[model samples]
Every structure is written in structure tokens, then in C-alpha cells.
Target: MLRFASLGSGSKGNATLIESGVNDKDTRILLDCGFSTKEVEGRLEKLGRTAESLTAIVITHEHSDHVSGAGRLSRKYNIPVWLTVGTSHACRDNDFYETHFINSHADFEIEALNLHPFPVPHDAREPCQFVFSDGASRLGVVTDLGYYTPHIISHLDKLDSLLLECNYDERMLLNGTYPHSLKKRVHGDKGHLDNKHASELLKKLDLNQLKNIVGMHVSEKNNTEEYASNALCEGLGCEQNAVSLASQAEGFSWREM
Candidate 1:
């Protein structure tokens, strides 16, 4: 069996837990450690997990909200960390327990799980997302992309589940209090996805086998759970409750695949 959950998601912090296989093949991978090591441990406790159970921590980028506690978490737990060479360089000062430089275009294995890392156009150094498989199922996660590309679309196609960014509502973002430059960056090609475009991207994907669809990393200032979830629901041609929303605090519970 394969399943996943979120420790937290949004601007304040971000982390995801993916677990696959069973018994000796059980592989637990933490996708990002955006919060402090202490906070991550507490959150995992709520989900019935501990740092020692983790097989590895795979970093998406070096942004504070994506990588802030990765090193400390790895060091405390004696878990290996895998990240792109450029992202590792950006975090050179961090003292990790173990480090494995990865390539954006490569596929790798961590015990029972297979991970396909792909580059994304986020502003952070060597940002990327991942597609995970446990032989029988596939799960795609994309949170920090600036914009969607054909290459990205290809990776996300035909998945069993997806955790996608619904960072902002375009109008709300444009009208919010962020400065003009900051606003541009959030909506730019190297920033994040607004509800409208996120919905559009969902429509382009093949969702016949999709069991779960979550709109993650929503903006507290620029979006509402209703707006973000509704947009995703519309694209998927499902009711509002069919779409799950991940908030900065109290992220949704585990969903199995």
C-alpha cells in the first residue's frame, strides 16, 4: 500500500510525508522540511510518525519555506538528504548528516520507492518537483513552480494522486497589500500558480485514475479555501468536497492510494 500526508503547507512552512511498501519494504520519504526541526517532529507526532522512521528527506529547493529545517532534521534523525547539486551548493553552510547530490533529470531509488526528479522554473536555485512510484501506483507533487510547462504536464500525466499548488487567486493577489514588485514576483513565471491557471492545468491532465486531488500551498492573504477548492472542483468536474485544501496550519489528514 501507498499513502501520504502533509505536516504543513503554505508560505509559513511546507512538508510532506510519503510512505510506500509494507513491513521490510516500508519506505517513508519526507518531501521537504520547511519548518523548524522541532516543529516538524511535533507535526509528525500528530500523524503517528517519528523522525527515526524516515528513510530519507528529499529537498525541492533552497528557499526558506522549502528547506529551512532539512539539515537539522536529517542530522537529528541520522537520515540521508537528497537534493540537486545546485540546491546543495546554495545550502553549503548547512551541516547535514549525509548528503547525496541528485540530478534533476534522473530517477533514483530509496529502498522500496522510486523517485523521478524534474526541474521546475521557480526562482530558487535548482528548484524541482518529484513523481513517486511504489510499483503499483504513482503520485506527483508540484508546489513551487513559477509556471507550468509542457514538460511539467508530461510528468504529471496519469497519476493516482496529486498535490498541486493553488497559491493565490489572481484578482485577490493583484488587489492585496503586497508591494508592486513582490506582487509581480508571486504571479510571475518563476513564482506560483493562481486559481485560474491552476484550474486550467488540471483540465489538461488525465484524471481517470486519480483517487485524490489536493490544492496545496494556498495563500492566506490572497486566497480562500472556498475559492481554491472550488476552482479545483470545477476543473475536475466534481463537487467542492471532492477537492481537499491544505492550509498553513493543520494540514489535511492522510489519504491512501
Candidate 2:
């Protein structure tokens, strides 16, 4: 079986755990480790797992909220970390862990799980999203991207599960308390995706095999669970309960594909 879980998802911090295989051969990977070592360990414990049990760590970018504790976790548990060359250079302080530079257009494998990383239009040095497969089921995770592109749509096609970013509601973001520059940054081409854009992207994807649509990286102040859920539901033409939101604290529990 192929399954995944998130430690948390937001500007505060982010981490996701993907697992595949059965019994003794099971392979577990931490997609991103943004929390402190103890915090990540505790979150993993909630899913009946531990950092020591992880097979590897794959970093999406050098943004603090996405890579804060990746180095510590990898060093503490002696787990290998995969990241792009630019991200590796951008994160000079996190040089303690054993690192493997990955190509954004290439595909790689870690035991039973196959990962394909693709570039995304984000402000970070070299941001990317991933798609994972255990030979049968595919899980696509696309967050922190500023906008959707045809390449992204092509890669996310036929996903069994998806964790897409729904960072904010347009009106709320423009009218919220954030400073002018911050607002522009969050709404710019290199900024995060708003609810409408996320919904539009979903409508463009092939959902024939999609079993779950998870809204992730939602803004705590600019977005609400209701709005994100409603937008996704409208785009998918599915019931509200069919969509799930990945929270800033509890995130959602594991779901199998």
C-alpha cells in the first residue's frame, strides 16, 4: 500500500511523511522537515513513527518554513538528504548533513518509492514539487508555487492523491493587515497561489484516479478552511466533505492510496 501524512503545513513550518511497502520492507521518507528535531519527532510519534525510521529526507527548497529542521533531523538520525544544487548552496548553514544534489528534471528512487521532482515558479532559489509512486499509486505534492504552468499540470495528471497549495483568498489578502510589500510579494508571480488559482489548476488536472484532494499551505490569517474547501469542491464538482485541509498544527492524519 502507498500512504502519506503531513507533520504540518503553513508559513510557520512544513513537513510531510510518505510511506510505502509492507512490514519489514516498508520505506518511509520525510518530504520536508521544517520543525525542530523534537517537534518533528513528536509529530511522527503521532503517526506511530520516528525520525530514526525514515529512509531519507527530500527538501523542496531553502525557505525557512520548509527547511528549518531538515539539517538537524538528518544529522541526528544520519539520514540522507536530497536537494537541488541551488537550494544546497542557498542553505549554507545546513551543511552538517550528508547531501545529494538532485536534478529538477530527473527522477530518482529510494527503495520502494520513486520520486520525480519538477521546478516551480517560486521566489526561492530553486523551488520544486514532487510526485511519488510505489509502482502503482501516485501522490503529487505541489505547494509554495506562485502560479501553475502547463508543465505542472502535465506532471500532476492522474494522481491518486494531491496536496495543492491554497494560500489565500484574493480579497482577504488585499484587504488584510499585511504591509504593502508583503501583500505584493504574496500575490506576485513568484508568490504563493491564491484559492482561485488553486481551484483553476485542479479543474485542469485529470482527476479520474484522484481519491483525495488536500488543500495545503493555507494562510492562517488570509484564508479559511471553509473558503478553501468550497473553492476546491466547486472546481472538482464534488461534495465539501470530499476535500481535506492540511492544518498548521495537527495537519491531517495518514490516508492510503
Q: Which pairs, if any, clash in model 1? A: 146-191
Q: What is the per-residue lDDT of model 2 for residues 1-257, given as tens digits with 9 covering 90 to 100?
A: 99899999999999998999877568998988889999998999998888888999999999988899988888889999999999988985566468888899999998999999999999989888999999999999987989999999999999999999999999999999999999999999999999999999989999998998799999999999999999899889899999999998988899999
lDDT per residue as tens, model 1, 135-210: 8999999998888999999999999999999999999999999999999999999999888888999999988999
Model number with the top TM-score: 2
**What TM-score does each of the candidates earn?**
0.97, 0.98
Alpha-carbon error at 64 in model 2, in Å? 0.5
Which stretches in model 2 have alpha-carbon errors above 4 Å?
none
Q: Worst lDDT window (10 residues) for model 2?
A: 91-100
Tell me, what's the RMSD of every candidate?
1.1, 0.8
